[model samples]
Target: MANKKPLILVTNDDGITAPGIRALISVMKDIGNVVVVAPDSPQSAMGHAITINDTLYCDPVKMTEDADHKEYSCSGTPADCVKLATQEILHRKPDLCVSGVNHGSNSSINVIYSGTMSAAVEAGVEGIPAIGFSLLDYSLEADFEPCKKYIKAITEHVLDKGLPKGVVLNVNLPKLKEKEIKGIKVCRQAKAHWVEDFDKRKSPQGRDYYWLTGEFINEDKGEDTDEWALSNGYVSVVPVQFDLTAHHFIQDLNSWELND
Candidate 1:
């Protein structure tokens, strides 16, 4: 909180070259010194995977002709990228770590499988405040201009007020024009899930294969949830915790007749 600009680690699941991350970097640069260490290729839905057996190769690269920020492309998952950045790349702990501006929504139950959120969670595990951002549009050419201003505001807020330990933010922007977008909304994650099915098929070698297919179903009608906020034209900001403990069920589990 001194005169020096904060160091911000920028990363994403949608590869280093993805437009989403590029847009994210533009916003982060305005707030702090940025160091980008992201996947060299798309690693969406990869969860919190880390590279153990295989070799991780990370090298600095220039993304644009006039680029001034430190950028590195890594051959690893989003989680691995954070680990490498903290352990090997950056000389000091970053003031904050930010992921995504992802090509699609990472709201509701999708968080479990999101590489974007996983990176932020990984940062949280390392005692760094973090946030993961996403947009409703899944297209590579999704218009990101409308979301940049909100992203800047949210990032500035997080920088001002550090997040709680073990907690990070999951932000989702609706695909709407800048003027049509409602203001930011702090909400809880919706109770939603995918009713998934695989499409069976045959390859050219006559081998069987299956492609993943699913429909997202939102069972909760609560208006205070992330899904509802996004549906109603606001940017959804959900505070997420990396802890997976089922603390509420511990008391009930103790009542089980185990000695009988």
Candidate 2:
């Protein structure tokens, strides 16, 4: 008898042609019937943005023309791609949504600026279990072989166990050889920040422009954080939630005199 397969929606911020997404697709094919709806161009640091001012478009692309999976290239943000997949592309709701085998890390405070994480978060908001995976290396030619087995394992686990409602997994893998990778760790996003330094320069016309640059600073020394895991050569999975309300602070604020 044939095995029952899950239906997975695959997307990424690094455009459809990115090697990261290609590696991701290769793994998902083993677990499900995959449908990929990804941006036509890289849209890093888009941070949950949507294409409100412009109309969105998607065209089916033949990545491997003879392959069983269906893929599309979309002219929109990562969030827009997820919206299109959920509302317009798929015939039914997907069992899971996996975003990003990102070319760079989206761990710690970087999640706030990540198009990768935002796509997964969008799916979580629509009540789909989601995950975003990234490797610590940022090079376009970075080897993803080390992450393939772990990625497959994690995908299978989520499909089997299912995630908690409204919570999506943000997984970051270290850029180490497969043997060097210790193991997986369920962790929290570290309390960290980027110290921004904009490089100011002048064009030939003497107009000033700024190029964004930053260095990451981890304030937390906790071993139970994504940062610690990556630094220690382990795959980190942070169960991220979409709720931004500080429920613990509501009662403290209620005691304040507002009309005094």
Candidate 3:
């Protein structure tokens, strides 16, 4: 008997109409059966947050006149979309889940705040092999043509060789042309952070407000890091595990004299 088509779930932080997710959908269409459940509006930097205190909505949407595939516009975080997709939307658990092809970078320390990666992490928690993709460019018009081939390749590879439990891939592509991209590299997350500054101002209504601004700081000089790969024209693939346990420090922590 021939093998059944793999069921794939597609989602993003940039809403249902973003060109990035469209590119992702186009690529995924060739790979397997795809169903998209993404935010109705941009939800960048939402982390792994899920809606609790408010009503969540996920409704059918038409992305294009000729496009044929199940699509839903969700009123929740990226994580919430994944939860709803698996629990209520999809008829069955997806064989794979992919998020983003985001309009900006989710490399280095940015993954902790990325709704893109969070969706992938959420799928990982449900035992689904997942990947979050991003481009370094912040432009809405950024060319995603270069990313399609790699996306197809990586997705096929994952389907053929399933991922380890509790792990998901965080992939970031440089903003260079297809020819300029050296290759894909498996690397570590570079030690990096955002140094934020808030612009405090009074609104015309006499209320104080703040807008966040920051500069990215990359402190790690290691060549085997995502930051280095992206800087040198390579696609960076970081294996992210959702486990937050500090296992190495557990023994030392237990030795502390807390009982006294």
Candidate 4:
């Protein structure tokens, strides 16, 4: 008897109908049995957030005429979509879980706030092989053509060779044409941060509000970093883990005199 086709769970932070996810769905359909559970609305920058105070809802959605795949839209964050998919939607554990093809880049420190990576990270926490893909372009109509081939290739590779337990992939593609791309590069996450600024304003009714904005500062100059890979026109693939423990400082922490 032949082995069953891989069960691939599809999701994104840009909502189910976004072009980026549609492109992702198209590619996954050719590779395996794809099932999508994503936010009903864009959930960008909602990092690892789940619904606790409110009831969650997930309903089947028909975004395309493709009969080979199933899709659902959830009224929750990207992370919640993953949890709900695995626990309630899927009949069995997915062979692999994939998030994004996000409209904007989730590289460097952005991963800490990205709903795309959060979804993938949630899957990793569940011991599933997962990946989150993103493009540098942020436009709602950004061309995703250059990313399709690479996305399919990377997904196929992950399905063939499972990721290490607790580690998920954060893949960021440069905003370059397919011919201009230098290929994929596996690298470490760069040390970077966002410097925020808030613009204060008053409405006609005298209510004041502030709009938040920031600039990304990349302080790491290493060639083996995700920042360098994306800057050099390569698709950066960073292995991200959910473990937040600073293991290297454990010995130093133990040496501190606490009972004194």
Candidate 5:
């Protein structure tokens, strides 16, 4: 008897040709059949945005013609790619949908603005087990070798155990040497945010325009947070839920009187 292979869907916000997605595709190939439908260009910080205002494009492409996977380039957001993969690309519902291997961190508050996580969340809405992986290193040429093995292990675990409905994993790997990696930790998102700074610069027209810039501020010192785990050389896996309702606060709001 042979083991049943899982069908995997791969995507990234950093475009179809990015090294991040390539690394992810290579790792997934070892686990199951991979079908990639990724953005044609970098769509970082796009959040859960979908392309509804214009026509979308998706062309079938062979990322690596080896005996493992098939790929496609999508002219839309990360969320768009996931929808296309589910509807037109894959023959049936995928066993798993993994997004990113993002070039930069999607930790803490940044997860709300990440195109990488959007793809995974989109899959989660469709009842597919999903995960989004990120590396703390933001440079395009940053070393990804340290993440390969850990990625494989995590993917295998999710494929075997399966994920909770309406929930998905957001995994972040620290930028450390392989030997320096402590271990993996299931954690919560830290209370952190970017202190926004708008860099004012004059263009050729002498009009000032702003380029957004900011620094990450980690206010939470909890040991169980994703920030703590990554800082201490551990892979952080945070279970993310899509329901945006603040259930605990709803009752309190109803108790207040309205001036209207």
Candidate 6:
């Protein structure tokens, strides 16, 4: 019997029309039947937010006249898109879910605030094999050609060998030419954070507002980390889990004299 094509859910934080998602959709079409549910506008660092305070809107959108995939634009976060897709859009549970090819890097601690990885994490929470892809470049016009092969390879591997429950992949590519890329590296998330600076400014009406900016600082000097992989022109793939429980600390907590 011939095997049925895999059903792949596609999404991103850069909106339904962003070049990043478009590039992702193109690659996914070659591998499976793709259905995209993404934010109508950029949702970048929205994390795992969902719509609870206001009405949620999701409508069919025509990305291109000849595009093959089914696409929907939603007035919600990336995480919400995954939830809605599984609950409201797809006829059956998808075989796999993939998010991003995000315009900016979602490596290290940035994953905590990344809408891209949040969508993938949401899928993992629902027991779906998932992955989130990002490039180190932040330019709107960044070339994604270098990532196509790696993305397809990783996606194929996940489909062939299903991921463990609660685990999703975070894949980050370097901003290098295809030939310049060294290879793929499976690694751990690096210990890093942003040193933030808010620029306070006054509008013409004298109202003050702040613009957030930050410098990324890598505190880990370990070579077996995602930061190191990307720095050396390799694609970094980190397995991420949605469970935030500090299970290792529980034993120490039990030893504390809290009962006294």
Clashes of each: 0, 0, 0, 0, 0, 0
Q: In candidate 1, which residue ranges exceed 4 Å CA deviation?
A: none
Per-residue C-alpha lDDT of model 4 across residues 61-139, encoded as one tens digit per residue: 8876756578899999998999999999999999888888899989999999999999999999998999999989889
lDDT (10s digit) by residue, model 1, range 205-225: 999999999999999999999
Candidate models: Cα lDDT each: 0.96, 0.94, 0.94, 0.91, 0.93, 0.94
- Residue 26 CA displacement from its true place in model 6, Å: 0.9
What lDDT tens digits, residue by residue, belong to model 3 across residues 1-260?
02788899999999988999999999999989999999999999999899999999999988788878999999999999999999999999999999999999999999999999999999999999999999998899999999888888888989989999999999999998999999899999999999999999999999999999999999999999999999999999999999989899999988996797
Q: Which of 3 and 5 is the better model by lDDT?
A: 3
| lDDT for predicted candidate 6 compared with the true structure | 0.94
Local error of candidate 1 at residue 188 (angstroms): 0.9
List clashing residue pairs in candidate 5.
none
TM-score of 6: 0.97
- Clash pairs, candidate 6, are none
| TM-score of model number 1 | 0.98
lDDT winner, 1 or 4: 1
Question: Per-residue lDDT for 67 in model 4?
Answer: 61
Cα miss at 58, model 4 (Å)? 0.7
Clashing pairs in 4: none
Better of 1 and 5 by lDDT: 1
Model 1: pairs clashing at backbone N, Cα or C within 3 Å: none
Superposed on all Cα atoms, model 5 deviates from the true structure by an RMSD in Å of 1.5
Superposition-based RMSD of candidate 1 using all C-alpha atoms, in angstroms? 1.0
lDDT of 2 at 118: 98
TM-scores, in order shown? 0.98, 0.97, 0.97, 0.97, 0.96, 0.97
Candidate 3's C-alpha runs over 4 A off are none
Q: In candidate 3, which residue pairs get closer than 3 Å at backbone N, Cα or C atoms, i.e. clash?
A: none
